[model samples]
Target chain A: MPEYASILFSEVLKILMLLVPVLVSVAMIVWLDRRVWAFVQKRRGPNVVGPFGLLQSLADALKYIFKEIIIPASSNKVIFILAPIITMTLALISWAVIPFSEDFVLADINVGILYLFAVSSLGVYGIIMGGWASNSKYPFLGAIRSAAQMVSYEVSIGIIIINVLLCVGSLNLSDIVKAQENVWYIIPLFPMFVIFFISALAETNRPPFDLPEAEAELVAGYQTEYSGMMYAMFWLGEYANILLMCALGSILFLGGWLSPINIFPFNVIPSPIWLILKILLLFILFALVKAIVPRYRYDQLMRLGWKVFLPLSLTWVVLTAGYLMYFDLLPGN
Target chain B: MIAHAVVFYIFSFIAIVSAIMVTTSRNTVHSVFFLILDFISISCLFIMIGAEFLGMIMLIVYVGAVAVLFLFVVMMLNVAQQKNEWFVASDSSSHIPIGLLVSLVIFSELLIVVGGWKYKAELQDSININLNLNLTNTQSLGNVIYTDYVHLFQLSGMVLLVAMIGAIVLTFRKRSGLKTQSYLRQISRERNEGVELIDVETKKGVKIDA
Candidate 1:
């Protein structure tokens, strides 16, 4: 193969390796989220599809394929169609920098964390576009709500990540995970971790911060106008985003692929499995919250993000930096 | 080198077209969306040139934040409804000439900067943007911003703080008749205050008022 063709072939293969599992796991995660929620609510989940309801997502995917796509007459035709595609694409692309294990990643850029942050921030555009294109009162309101909610929480998330970055002294995702070999950032940065987890929940618009799609109020929120595959795209994008946040949380706090104890038998398991388990742990929590918590009023959600998390995270950043400086424990670049 | 030029031109093309659309779009929302596209493409150009930190910051601050605010305001104000009238006749028509003059001044200033750079490409090293080839983009930026330009950076932060405070002061108001939730009061209230038992005689109900 020519140099460029070889590069292209390898890159395409890597993308497939990463994305195929991601798309498949999205299906699995949907099933897992439903099962967890059902367990929390004391109800049997979708056991009718396949053994242990494993093929439920496949059935759902087929249903979406067969269903009719309805475009509103007054809707912005181009953007309405583009919205879900953009959402799903952006969600998948953010995985490019997410270090699954030590050297296993699509693109191991130096500023990987920032790239993730940047991509996640752009996630709001899909919702905004979908809502705006729908040309309906409820969708517009939902989009506006989503924009404010995301923007407000992002500040705190950025600050909280700074606390981790300070310790790691590098922006590379692999370096961040490596720094936690001795002890996870969660031990020292417990408060920031909790705040980060909550912010992650809000960032992904999971309940109780899921006011954008509160169902009772906005009638499916931004998804109101979407039908068939378009609606399924939004659902897939959302779950992927949720999974991304879980991966991020695990990477930042729980030690990305590190075993619980650095001993024999415990360390025998592969790193990727550890990452998957940590992600599953976070996903279960996400689903449980969905089942257990009541939806927040829009005002309370804003108050929590801005009034509470922002100041708390900002102060924690200062405090952590101060502590590091005082102890002369600042990692050399 | 050929691939680099190709990618550069591609991103630059997108940035320029989106920049034009931002100004020419009839719908205010479309203008905002184009502005976001412009930001993204410009940031892509930045990243392609290895200024990854700057590129990501641009995306986060502008595409993610500023454009969203623009979209929110445009959507809420229903600016598209009056787009034709704004083009034809507007109460703020007098300000248009002044706006054009200010824009011309800024544009000329940018032109001068670019022209100077074109003549003196090596003049960059004398200034603060001394890039160390060994260090990563984020590290180099941190080194410069925190070491040599630390005071200036701190001052800029202070300026931002003051501006934020000033904006809050401008918007903050005390409304006499406005009803607002006092979370502290709500939480601290005694059970007796919230619930009361009153004796009722015959068919008459207890007075809930007072």
Candidate 2:
């Protein structure tokens, strides 16, 4: 191969290494989501597919593949098809910056967090496109609702991340993680972590903030008009985003790849395993919140994101900066 | 390198095409999507030029928030169905010459600036940014924004704050005969007020209103 072709081949291989696991894990995560929801409701969830229903997600994907794809006659066909592709693509690509372990990232860019933020922000287009292209009232309403909800919560998310940034004084995700070697941010920035988790829920359009797709009101929101593999793509993208948020939570607060007790036995484990475990822990909390918490009304959700979270996170940013400066511990000073 | 030039041309082509399509697209939603595409392409160019922070920020701020809001309004209203009126003949078409003249002047001015820049390349450093090539793009930009140009940065922030407040004040409505919940009053209500201990009579019924 030529030099450029060889470089391209290796890059593609690297991307596959990162993405394949993420997509596979999305399957298990969905199964886990169902199991948790079932456990909360005292029911057996998908035990028929495999032991503990491990292969259920695979079966679902197969079913989606075999099913007929129906395009609504009134819909805009180009955008209708483009939306889900964009969703899944963006969701998967954001993983390029996420460090699984020290020196394990695909793209160790300097502006890693900003790159993630940028990709996640573009995520709204998928939902909005699917909604508006449907040419239906329900999807349109859902799209409009999510656009407002996302933009509102993104402000607070940015502020909360700034608190973490101030401590580390770097935008690199790994640097942020390394800064937590002494103590995880969860101890000191507990409130900001709580707000970030909640905002993550809202950002992913999960429960307690899933006004965009409220079944009672909007009939599955933006996903209503989608069917077959299109619907499955949305489901995959959503779970992937949820997992990304979980990873982010672990990296920012729970100390990515850092064991709780740094001893001989604990230190023996590889770094990636610890990162996965932390992500799983955060993901379980997400599933539990989904199972237990009732969805919020739209107005209440807006009030929480704007009125409460905005002011609180902003104040926390100032406080963290002040505390860091007062001790003459500001990074790079 | 050849690769750099190729990538630059690709992104610039996409940006130019999308910029043109933003006005030409019949559907308002499509126009907004085109605008997003234009932003994305330009940001790609920024990133290719090694300004990763600016590129990402452009994506987040312009393509993400501003364009999403544009799509929101275009979708929510019936504006998506509105036909494109570009180049359409109107009753009074007097502004065409003035528009052409203004654009011509601007184009020539751009030409002059570019042509003169080849001879006087040093003019680019008039701002004295003191950019340290050792620092990463984010760090260098931060150093400049937070230290030397701090007051200007803060003033711009103040402008944005004032604009936000102005928007809110204009949109804020005080209406009479509307029921709104006062959360403090609702939360502070006594249990005695909420519940009545009186027993109800069998058929006569208690006057609950009283």
Candidate 3:
């Protein structure tokens, strides 16, 4: 009983260790995204709160917390409140299988990547529920858009990951990272990497494909009715999900926790730091894409996802399988 | 063992309640939400029973994809406001007695199956496959799926392909009047073809070709 108790305690501690840093990073990411947007536009952004507005996210959080949560009178009150909680929970839970380093993952399950995929695929629920519960037209439209968009992009992402899994031969994320010790999958599967990154952008509802929440048209999309902390929860969940996707990209393509070059200075830094650096670099790319790329038209976005990316990723999967089989490089073979 | 039973009971309880709610809910959207809850609870049950892969896939397929599609259709059709009347409507009143009788019969049949299985140990011999405890659920599933069940898997794939093609073919419409961008024309246009410089009087715009 004592041993079980200790196990439970340690598990809680580990979850806290993962959750706190993730929550903090989510806040910082919001700040970072704004700053990046500002830099792209040649303007100083959020410079007043702290040094270079370091505490801007904190201030925002405080403001959100103090504000009144205005629930729409016509809305399904229970579902409206439950939607953000689901989103935030799902966003955070996918990190369970993400290996920070060799031994640091919360759950080193067999189907790690599948677990991540499942959690991410479920993210559409929050949007759908929120939109529906709002009892509004724009939110409903936004929800429908998000549903179709996520489903379409997920097909491509699934195929792309299957290509990686073909090379790695294991669903365990740590195994994937370990396999990249000699050569990152991105080196050989460059096109797949790019496709995965773009799909990740769409899956996370990032810019260029963020038609679900296209503010100009949909008035913040499914988030139209949300306000105060409820709205902030959605925001935090979005950034957290973005960070999760960045981590996933780093893990799958950039060699999670692995040094770029095995030279003296590069190898000196610890593994988690390497993971963090890769994630930050990817996050920067995400922000840059948001800044540079114009938002895709709805039809154009659908075309890119289904017509272009789907076939491309599917072909890559076949090519990858053939190559692995021909060269006798298939893992477990 | 006690903890396992406790968790199992909790999940099963939630699953049963949510399953009931899925059918009984007045709002269509609420019904879909309850259906999602039902899937999630059942998946949790699967995971607890050591079928983690199946549980995760259940989550990915049903709760994630299928339920979202249901919600999409519900929201898109604007049917969330429609209150479901199971037996209250006059025209559907006859369905109430029949439904209750059928449900009762089905429930008894299930109960009989369970009770009979408990007493007849030899009946289990009808089952051909046994769970391989040594391998992970995914590994075992892969082994069977790629080997003995490969044909069945491919058949299912073909079914899905046909369904997809059918959906596309049914919904696809080619409207003639809409002006669509031709990428090839846009990209292939040269400076000479796209531009024409002519000396013209400032007041009289060169007769633009209609």
Which ten-residue region of model 2 chain A has the weakest summed lDDT? A254-263
Clash counts per candidate, in order, are 0, 0, 0
Q: Give me the displacement of residue B29 in model 1, in angstroms.
A: 1.1
True contacts kept of 3: 0.85
lDDT of 2 by residue, A1-333 (tens): 399899999999999999999999999999999999899999988899888889999999999999999999999999999999999999999999989888889999889999888888999999999998998999988988998899999899999989999999899999998899999999999999999999999999999889999999999999998999999999899999999999989999999988877899998898899999999999999999999999998888889999999999999999999999999989876
CAPRI-style class, candidate 3 = medium
For residues B1-210, write the lDDT of model 3, one tens digit per residue: 888999999999999999999888877778888899899999999998778899999999998788887876776553523444433487577787998999999999999999999999777573576766777778888988999999999999999999999999999999999988777899999999978888998898788795
Report the lDDT tens digits of candidate 1 across residue range A28-104. 99999989989888999988988999999999999999999999999999899999999999999999998888889
Candidate 2 C-alpha error for residue A135, in Å: 0.3
State what share of the real interface contacts each candidate retains. Answer: 0.88, 0.96, 0.85
Off by over 4 Å in 1: B89-100, B118-122, B125-131
Model 3 misplaced stretches (Cα beyond 4 Å): A1-3, B78-88, B94-134, B190-209
Model 2 stretches with alpha carbons more than 4 Å out: B80-122, B125-131
Clashing pairs in 1: none
Candidate 2 share of real interface contacts: 0.96
- The DockQ-derived docking category for candidate 1 is high
Query: What local distance difference test score does each model get?
Result: 0.92, 0.91, 0.90
- Model 1 TM-score relative to the real fold: 0.96
For B177-198, candidate 1 gives per-residue lDDT tens digits of 9777889999999999898877
Best by lDDT: 1
